[model samples]
Target: MATTDDSFNGLTEYCDECELDTLHEVSVQIRTESTKKENAQFSREPYRVSECQRCGHRTSQRMNNA
Candidate 1:
């Protein structure tokens, strides 16, 4: 399980209509060689993107993964 500290944290985007910063919750599922000791070729890594519900703004900020 990945913790919030394991993610990069930052503002996902700025809503021009609301004039407020939209916070995003982004998660990246990575498959590494170290993680696949049992099965090296069975890594299903994917990225997750979500926008702020309040502002309806979307952005894939790389900084919000801490």
Candidate 2:
């Protein structure tokens, strides 16, 4: 399972409509990718959906683990 941290919790993003980095609500969707290897486990990726609390502006970003 993917856990949300303070950095990517959607409150730090800049909202164009609000013209600032304001509070936002974040929703995460987990996707599993199947591997062809015989003993390989599936890889999990999370897509973050964020909506501005003030203006309801929405944006999405895929999380990268590196």
Q: Indicate which candidate wins on TM-score.
A: 2
Clashing pairs in 1: 7-65, 7-66, 8-64, 8-65, 8-66, 9-64, 9-65, 9-66, 10-64
Backbone clashes for every candidate come to 9, 0
Looking at candidate 2, what is the lDDT of residue 29?
Answer: 82
What value of lDDT does candidate 1 attain over all alpha carbons? 0.48
lDDT of 2 by residue, 1-66 (tens): 223446554455678899987778888888665565653455767888888777899977778775
> What are the lDDT scores of the predictions, listed in order?
0.48, 0.71
How accurate locally is residue 27 in candidate 1, as Cα lDDT from 0 to 100?
A: 49
Give the least accurate 10-residue stretch of model 1, judged by summed lDDT.
1-10
- Candidate 1 per-residue lDDT, tens place, 1-66, comes to 222333357434455556765555554544333465687666444445455546665543233333
Task: Please state the error at residue 40 of candidate 1 in Å.
Answer: 12
